[model samples]
Target: MAIFEKTPQTKAILDDTEKLVCTIANAQNINKHTEYILRVHRGVSKEDKWNVSHRYRDFAALHGALQAARRDLPLPPKKLLGNMHPSFIAERQIALQNYINEVLKHTILALSLNVRCFLDPSNYPANLTEQALQTVSIALRGEGRYELKGPLPEIGWRIRKHYFMVTDTESHANCLLCWQSYGPDRHLCDKDLQTAFKCLQNLSHPHIDQILAIHNLETGAYVVRKVHETGTLRDMIYGTEYSKSYLSKYGNPKTRKPLTDGQIAHYGLQLLQALKFLHDKGLPHGHIHPGNIAIENQKVLLLDIENTLLGVANVHRPYIREHRKTSSAEAIDVYSFGRTLYEMALAETLEEPYCDIFPCNMSNDLVSVLRLCLSSSSCKHGMPTIESLLRHPLFSRPLVMGNGVHSDGATSLRVPSQLKEEIKMAVAVMEARLKAEQKLVRGAKREVRIQEILGSEEEMRKQKRRAKKRESVWKSTSSLAETVRSQSVSTASSPTPPHHTSDAPACTNGSSSTSASSAPLASPVAAGGTQQTKVTNEAPATNGRSALLSAICSFDKTRLSRINSE
Candidate 1:
C-alpha cells in the first residue's frame, strides 16, 4: 500500500530518462530587428539540433494558428499594447521562448507542432524558411572546414511534464512519486513542473523544494523532489490523511489553525529569503499562492518557480490576474509575495477587498511588515527590497528551531537548528580567512617598502659619486686659469729698455698704459676666483643635502603609500 512494486516499466522509465535531452543553446537577436534566433538542441546527437528565428508577431501568429487548428486547446494571453518598449519586448521574447519550450516538453503539443512546422523548417513562412536554411548552410560550411569532429555534449536533465504525489518511505523520508497519465490534458501540471525545472537551478534552502531526479517513461515523464514530511502550508492549515495528522498536534483549540504569530514569522522569513535568492538571480516566481508552498518536516518550502511569465508558455492564471498587469516582473513577484504575507498573517486565503486583518493576538512588528507588503503603491515606495524585508524587526528576535515565541517576545523563523548553526560557522570561517588575508597583504607591503628603501640608498650613493667627480674637474680648470693669468701679467710688466732712445720712451709709455688696463681685468678675475672657491667648497654639501633630502622624502612617501594601501 506504500511504495510501488519494482516492475519492467520502472526499469524502462529509468533507462529512457537518460535518452530524453533538451537544451537551449543560444537566443540571438536577428538583424537588429524584433525577431530572435533560437538554437534548440535535442538529445546528444548532432542530427537532433535545429535553429529558428521568431519575432513577437510570429509568436502571436503561431498562437492564432494553433487556436484555429484546435478549438479545445487553451492558449496563454497575448500582449495587446506596449510591445514597442524594449523591456516589454525582452520579457515577451522570454515568454515566447518558454512557450516554445513548453510545447516541446509535452508529447501532445510536441507532436502537433512537429506536424505543423518544426518537422520541416520550409513549412514556415518564406522569410523564416530562408533564414533557417541560411543558418543551416552556414553551420554546414563551418563543419566541412573542420578537419575533425566529435559527438556533442548531452542536454540538461531532459525532463518532460508529469503528475506527482508526496509519499513517505519506510525509512521515514519523504519522496515525490510522479507518473505520466494519458487521462486528461494535464498540461497545467506539466506547466508547473517545467516552470520549476527551468526557472530555478543550483539553488538550495531549507524552505525550498529542490529537484532531485527525473524518470521518463514511454507513456510519460516523472520528476522527483526533496521535501519535508510535515507536508505543505496548505495541508497544515487544512489537513492531510497521508501522514500523522499535523492538525491534531499543532492546531489551535478554538480555531483549529496551527499557524499563529510565531509560525507566520518563521514562514515569512524563509519565504522572503527564497524570494531574495530568486530575485538576485533575476528570476521572478510569478506563482506564489498557498497551494504551491510546501512544509517539509518543519520547514516552509517555496514550490513551482517555472510559472514565471515565460515559464508557463503564457497560460492565464488567477494569481497573475489578481496582481496588476505591469511591465516590471520583479514588482509583480513582490506584490504577490506581499499578498502571500497578508494571507499567512491572517491564516486564511485572501479574497477580494482584502482589508488589514491584524488580530489582537498578532504581534505589531509582524503586522507592520505585512502592511508594507500589501501597500497598493509602486514597489519603490510601498514595497522595500527583499534585502530590506529580511532585516525587519520580526527576524531580529532570537530564532528558536521548530516554533514557539522567542525570548525577545517576537516570533521568528526557526526552520532548523542545524541550518542556523551552519550559517554561523560559515560566517566565522570567512571572517578568519579575511583577517589572515589582510595580514598577508600588510606583510607584502612591508616587504615592498623595504625593497624601495634599498633602491633609494643605492640611488643616493650614485648621486654622491657624480657630485665628487664634478667638483674635482672644476678645481683643476680653475687652477690652470690662475697660473696662465700670472705668467701674462709678469711678461707685460718687464722693462724692454735697449731699443732706440726715442722709441724706448714711447714703448715704456705704451707698456705702462697696457699694464694699467690689465690691472683692472685682474680685479674681476680675482673676484670670480673668490666666488668659484666659495661655490666649490659649499656646492657639494648643499647639493648633497638637497639630493639626500629629496631621496629620503621620496622614500618616506613611498613607504607611507604602501602603509595606507595595506
Candidate 2:
C-alpha cells in the first residue's frame, strides 16, 4: 500500500524523472517559469512534471527507503546542514501546512516538529553521513511538528534552494537544526541562496557554480541556480567543432600542432588558479570535469556541487559500495579531478595536429601532471596534493617564454617598473578577502541571536514576519510606481553607445571593416614588433572626408614597453 505499483500516472512521473536526470550536456531545473500543472494535466507534459503528485510520490518513496536504514544509523544534529534563516523556518511551516492540508491529514506534532535545516556546500564537512540522511523527520504542516520521512540524500533533490540535498529524512531533521540551534544563520538561508544566484556575484572563484535564493513555500524548498545555455564542458570539447577551434588557436601555425608547450602551460595555469581559489577555501570540487564546467556569456563556470567533495567523506551520498574509509574516500576525489583534467585536455587536443603532424601539440611534455594522473598509476607518488600540482616545476613556468630577464634575451607578458602597481592591487585583494570573511561571520552570529529570540515566541514572531513581508511587498510596489513616475523624466537622458567624432577614427586607419582592420588592432605591437603602445594615431579628419587607413594600422612595441614601465 506504500510503494506505488504499476500505474499510468506513476509510470509517467518516473519517466520524466529519468529524462530530467539522464539528460546529457545540459543540467536541468524545475520549470517554475511555467504555470503549475492542475490535477488533470499532472503528468501530461514534461513541464507539468514537478506538480504536487510528483513531490508526494517522491517523498513517500524516499521515506520508505530511509526507514530501512534507521535500524543501523542514528540521525545527526542540525548544524551539519548550514545557514538556515528564521524567516525560512516560519515560511516553510506556513507553506507546508497549506500544501499538506490539501493532501494528507496529519497533525504537526503527530507528524514533524516544525524545523528548518541548512546544509552548507562551504568546506563540505564530513561529519554528516549516509546514515545521517536516513530516517530524518519532516515537518508536518498541520501540527507544526515533524514526522519521520526519509534520509536526505544529496542524490537528486535540492532544498531551500542551496542547502542540504537529502534523498531521505535526516535532511528534514537537519533543516530543523538551523531553526533550533543557530537561529540567525538559518535566517540567512534564503539570503545566501538568493545572493548566490545574483549575477556579477563574484564571491566564489570564477569557476564554481553559484547558488541563488532558496524559495521555501507550502510544498518544499526549491534550490535556485542560474540558467546555462552552452551546456556542459564534457559535451563541448568532445564535439568536433570545439576541438578544432581550440587546436587552431593554441597550436603551432606552421605544423598545425594540437597545442604548443606555451598554450598547455597557459590553460593549465588558468585551471590551477581556479582550483587554488577553491581549495584554499577548503572547497575541493570532488567532481571537476569539462562537463561540470559551464560557459555562460563566455565565462567559465564550475557547476554541480551536490556531488562536490570537501575535506571529509561523510558529506557525499554514495550510490555504489564506496570505501567508507575517510582517507580513501577523500583521496578518490583528487584522482577523479586529475582524470577529468586529462579528459578535458585530451579532448581539447584530439585533432589532426595533436594526433599525427604537430610535434609540439602532441608532445608528452604537455600537461605532464595530468598525463601522469591519466596513466594507470594515478596518484602513485603518494597522492600529491593539488597545492603541489599548482607549484609543480612545469606549472610554475610562464605560458609563452622567450628569453630570460637577466641574460640578453626576450620575454612575453612584459615586466616593467609599473608592475609594482599591479603588486599593490594583488595585495589589496587579499586584505579585502580577510575583511569580507570577518564581516560575514559577525553578521551570521547576529542573525542567529535574533532567530533564537524570535523562535521562542511563535505567535508574536508570526505577526512581525507578516508585517515585514507585507512591508517589503509594499516597498517593491512603491519602487515600481516610482519607476513609472520617472518614465517622464527619462526624456532628459540619452541612450547610445559612445561613438568617436569625425576627427577620431575607430581604427587607426579609419577603416569601417573590422575584419580587415590593421594588425595593430590585434595588439598594440609596432610594425617591426617594437612595443609602442602609446603611439597615438593621427588626428581624425574634421571634415566629412576619408583618409587612408594604413596610418591607423601602425604599431610600436617600444611604446608598449614604455606604457608598461610607466
Candidate 3:
C-alpha cells in the first residue's frame, strides 16, 4: 500500500508476538482487556460475553444448557469447529478469550508505540477480514498443501501478543521501538505517517538510513526501515567519550574530553547540508540537533525526520488542510528544535548572559540568523533570520574558542558553518529591524541597546532567507573538508604549508590580524586629541578562516554603503 494514502485501521497489527502473549495470558486466567469494543465488520468488536451475559460462568451455563437440550437433535451440522460436545461451549469460551486477548495486544502495538511496545516482523493474511478462519484451514492442510482454495488471503496478520515484564518506575515507552507494523497507526496520525513515510522513502540520501520496503498487507500498509545497531548520539554524550568537559554543564560528574572543534565543525556541517537538502524538497529537518543525528554508513544519518515538515510555508497548513486536529505543526517543531540547538551547540551560545555579543559558534554570519530562530514571540525582541546574522561582525571573521564561561572544562561543540552563516546573517537582519516596541529596560543604554535591537531584527529576516537557500553548499564544504581532513591525517608528521590564497588571505601569516580592528575598516576615529581604536577580537581556530573570508567578501560588497555612511 502507498504510505501516503490514508486508510482506516482495518487489518492493522504488528505480528504474532501478541498471540504468544495471549497464550500466556490464557494460562494465567486474567479478564480480557476490554478497551477495544467489538464492531466485527467495523473493527475489533467489544460486545461483552455471549448474547447479553457478562460473567464467564453465566455464558458457560447458558451454552451448556442449550447443548444438553439438543442432545438428540440431528447433530447440528458438524462443519464449524468439532461439532459442539457437552463441554464444547466452555472450551469455545476459552479459545475465543485467547483470540481476543492476542488480537488486542497486537492491535495496541500497531496503534501506538512506546518503550514497552514494538512491531513484529512476520507474515499476514492477504485477506484480513477472515484471517483467523483461514489460518485454521491453512494449518490443518499442512502449509502449502491446500489445493481447494479459491483466491488466496491477500491482507491480514500473523501478529499475536506476549506478556512483557515491565517495571513501575520505567514506563513502557522508554525502550521498545517498532520493528514492523500494519496500517494507519493511531498515535502516528495519518498526516505524520504520510509525511514521515514520504521523507524516509524520498530523501534518498547516502548518509540517511534507507527504507527497505513499504507493504500493503490487509491490516493496512506498513513500512520497513534500516536500523543502526551501533547507537544514538545521546548514548555517546551522556555515556562515552568527550564527557569530562561537559560534566560541569550538568550535575552529574564524569570524565571525558569533548569532541575537538574540528570534529564539531565536520559533523555540524553535515547536519546543515542535510537540512538544506530537506529544505530543497520543500521540507525542513526541523529537529536538527546532535542527539537526533546519527553516524552511520560511514557518515552522519538524520533520524526522526518523519516528525518534521516544510519550513515557514507550512506554519499555517492546518488552517488550509481540513484534516487532523494538529495544534502542533512542523513550524512549531522547528522553533522547538532551535531552542534545543541553543543548548547543545558551542560554549558561547550556551554562556549567553546578554543578547548583544551572543557568539556565533557556527559562522559569524549565521549568529544573527540563529538568534532570530532562538527568539520567541514572548520576548521583546522580534524573530531573527540567517542573512542578517551573516552580516553581523561576529560572522565577518573566524571564531575564537577560549571564551567559555562554564567551569570544569565545558567543551564546546562548534556550530556548523552552514548553521553559523545561516544564523549570523539572520541575526544581522533581525537586529537592524525598526519594529516598534512598547517599552524599554531602564538600565540599558539606548546606544548599547540599539546595537542589540538592530542586530536582533536583522538576524530574524536573514534566518527565513537561509532556510530557503540551496543546501548543496554544505555538501560542497563537506567534500572540501573531507579532502583536507584525510590529507591532514595522513601528513601528520609533515610541516604544514604557509597561509596563502589557498588558505586565508587576511590570515596567511599567523600575525595577519588577531584584532578585528585591524581590518580595512579599522581606521582611526579621532576623539579628544586621541585616536580611539574600536577593537573587536576575532574568534580563534578554523572559524577565523571563515570569518576572514566573510569579512573580505562583506568589505568588497559594502564599499558603497561604507563610503556613504562615512
Candidate 4:
C-alpha cells in the first residue's frame, strides 16, 4: 500500500521545503553525446513524477543563463578528451544531477522560467506566452464583447498568469486583460467560481478598481479591467524600468523612489478603507501588494480583489505562515498591508527575522503603526483590524491636500440572493482552506527545524567520538614513552660487578700471575662492554619511542585543529 493515496484531481501545494527534487535515473548515448533521463517530482508521490531528457549542452546552457544570478553554481567542467566514454559519462551524469539539484534549491532559480521550461517542457513550454495569447484571444472572441490587442509580455510575477491589452467594443475603451490558470489551489468549483466573478463584477467602492468583465473557462479565467495609464502602484514607485521582469522589479527595490510621509498616509488610509469595505461584505483580497494596486490621480485603487476567490496563494504566504495569528482572512490582509506599508516606507521588501526597530528619522506615529502591524508581539497576539488602522493617528490626520477623493460614495455591493450566499460560502470555504494550508506550512517548517537540530546533534556526537579516539592514541603513546624511560633508568641505576678476582691474580708471580691478572681484567672489560652495548641498543629503542610520541603528538594537534576549524 502507498503512504499517500493518489487523487488525480487534487493537486498538492508545494512549500519551500518541498522543492523540485530530480534524479538522473538513467542515461543513453545518442549520436555522439549522452543524454540523461531525469526523474523529477516536487514531493514523494508517484502521481507527481515526470521524466525529462537533456544532453550535457542543455545543462550548460541553463548554467550559463543563471550564472549571473548565482555565480558559484556547481556546474561540472566540460571534458574534451574521452567525452563519450561510458565511465566519464556516468561520472558526468552524477555531477550534472548535483548541479541541477543545487540550482533548484535556490527559490529564485527554481522559479525561473528558464529552469521551469528546462525541467518540464511539456508543461512550461517555450511558447507559453504565445499559448496564453492564443487562449485569451479565443476566449475574448467567443464572448464577442472585447477585442484582444496584444500581449503584455513579462509584466507580472506569476508563471501561469498572462496579461494583455484589450479594447471593449461597445465603449471602445482600452482595458487590461488578465488570463490566469485556475491552478491546483483553486478553492471554488466552476459554478461557484462563476458566481464569485459575477459578484465581483457588481462590486463598487471608492477605492476598488471595477472589473469590467469576467469570463471563467474550464482551465482558467479571463478578467478585464480598465487600464490605468499610470500603471500599477509599483510602477509609480519603481519607475517601471524593469517592470517587465518580475525578478528585477522586486530584486532591486532600493533603487526606486519611496513614498513620502504624506503620500504614505494618503494611500495608506485609502487602502485601509478599501480593505474594511471588503471585510464588511465578508470578502478578503488575499493578494495585496504594490503591484496589485494602481494609482490614478493620487487616489489608490485596489486591484485583483477576486484573487482570494480564485484560490491563488498569497504573495506573503511564507511570511504569513510563520505567524499563527494571521490564519484568519482579516488578519492575513492586515499582515499583507503591513508588508506593503514597510516597502513603501523603506523602498525595500521586508526580509525575514522581522524587527520592530525603525529609522530614527521616521515619524513616531508611523513607527508605532508599523510596530503594531509587524512586531513579533503583533504576530503572536494579532494584527490590528482594518477598521482600527483607519482610525490610527497616522491615517486619521486631516489631509492638507484633497488626495484620494472620489465621487463614488456607494460602499455596498448588491447581488442576487443566491449569488450572495454563494459568495459568502465561497469566502468561508477559501478562508478555511487558507487556514488549513497555513497549518500545514507551519508544521513543515517546524519539522525542518527539528531535523536541522537533530543533524547538528548527530554531528556533535561524531566529533566527540573522533576526539575520544585521538585522546586514546595520545594516552597509548604516553604509556609507551614512559615504559621506555623506565627501562633506561633501571639499566643506568644497577651497579657494575666489582673486579673481585683481582686479589688472587696479584698474589701470583710476575709473568704467570700477569697473564692471569690480564685474563680477569679482560672479564671486567667484557662486562663493561656488554653494559655499553645494552645501553646503545636501549638508546635506539628510546629514539624510536620518542619519534612515535612526536608523530602521535603531531597527528593529535592536526586532528584537533581540523576539528576546531570544522
Q: lDDT: which candidate is best? A: 4
Q: Candidate 4, after superposition: displacement of residue 246 in Å? A: 3.9
Tens digits of per-residue lDDT for model 1, 174-240: 4553332221111223333333343344455555667554332323443446544565565556554
* TM-scores for candidates 1 onward, in order: 0.34, 0.29, 0.30, 0.74
1-566 per-residue lDDT for model 3 (tens digits): 23666544553333122122222122122353111112221111122112121233432332343231122211112125443343654454555455434333332222211101211112333233244344333432442322222222111112221111111122322111121233221233344445445435654654454544332223334233343445444434444332111212222324323443444434444444455455544344444444456675436677645432211112112111211211222333334334434444432123221233444345443454445544333123333332333344532333322222111322122333444343334323322221111111122244568899899989987886786564667778889999999998877955443234655445343332433234233332222212121221335564655654554333321332335535
Model 2: residues with Cα > 4 Å off, grouped in runs: 1-202, 215-221, 240-265, 296-299, 306-330, 348-361, 376-381, 400-566
Tell me the TM-score of model 2. 0.29
Best-fitting candidate, scored by TM-score: 4
lDDT of 1 at 438: 38
Alpha carbon lDDT of each predicted model: 0.46, 0.35, 0.35, 0.73
Count of backbone clashes, every candidate in sequence? 8, 68, 116, 0
How many residue pairs in model 1 have overlapping backbones? 8
Q: Distance (Å) between predicted and true CA of 479, model 4?
A: 4.2
lDDT tens per residue, model 4, 468-513: 9999999999999999999999889866543443322223222333
Give candidate 4's root-mean-square deviation (CA, Å).
14.3
Tens-place lDDT per residue, model 2, 511-560, is 35443343334444234433232222343454213333343344333354
